[model samples]
Target: MKLHVFDTFAYSKTGKILHFDVLLSERNEVKAHQRAIEWLDSIGEQGATIKPRGCTFCHTVADAPQFADEVARNGYAIYKLEGCPA
Candidate 1:
């Protein structure tokens, strides 16, 4: 059961797409990946500024690459965090 944490972050460039990091633990890997995808999809369905693949949550970024890379190396793909456009 691997646990994955999702955090969000903004890029240095202006108008750059938002970014997010998905953290993963060996025990919650499978569920975390599934949840990550689901969360993205949910965000997208709402017609969110950022699409599922593009938008990310704050938690995903606060932790950072180290938090998500672990999951990526295993199998889960990372989603770049895009903020809710105003």
Candidate 2:
């Protein structure tokens, strides 16, 4: 499966910038934005907001087995880039 990658960044409540990628099987901006927020919330960044400008379509790539498996279980998968909690 081909996955659409959305490069997303947002500021946490503590003013730390978090960089991550939202990968989806389909290219839907709305869904991508929602997924970004969901991931932020999951990582205890409930106060972080993913503005439309913050999340932009980056590129599409063939899904790896791990990513494909995760996307199948969840609606989307996130690839943490920077400033994300371990």
Candidate 3:
């Protein structure tokens, strides 16, 4: 599973991401989407602000029809880990 990387600095600048998240769903797109929404709701309780891909920082894959479509493409967060070597 590969998650498209999000720029931490950019996230900070945009004030869009309050916490980092990584999700792994079954290979099925429908289940993946359901999990994504759940993650959003669950983390939102903790003030984590993550959206599928349409929030405000999806320039990388603008051609994607929607954020759920983006999530269905991979089994991870759309953003990369903050301190890992990508």
Which predicted model would earn the best lDDT?
A: 2
lDDT (10s digit) by residue, model 3, range 5-74: 2322213233654333333323334443444445455544333334454232222432334445555765
For model 1, state the Cα shift of residue 2 in Å.
2.2
Candidate 2 residue pairs in clash (backbone atoms < 3 Å): none
Number of the top-ranking candidate, with TM-score as the measure: 2
Residues 15-80, model 1: lDDT tens digits = 444455555553343455465555455555222233343323233233445435545665554445
lDDT of 3 at 27: 33
Worst 10 residues of 3 by lDDT: 4-13
Off by over 4 Å in 2: none
The residue-by-residue lDDT of candidate 2 on 1-86, one tens digit each, is 89999999899878888999999999988899999888888878898976667998999997567799899999899998999877
Q: Where's the lowest-lDDT run of ten residues in candidate 1?
A: 53-62
Error of 2 at 17 (Å): 0.3
Ranking by lDDT: 2, 1, 3
Backbone clash total for model 2 is: 0
1 or 2, which is superior by TM-score? 2
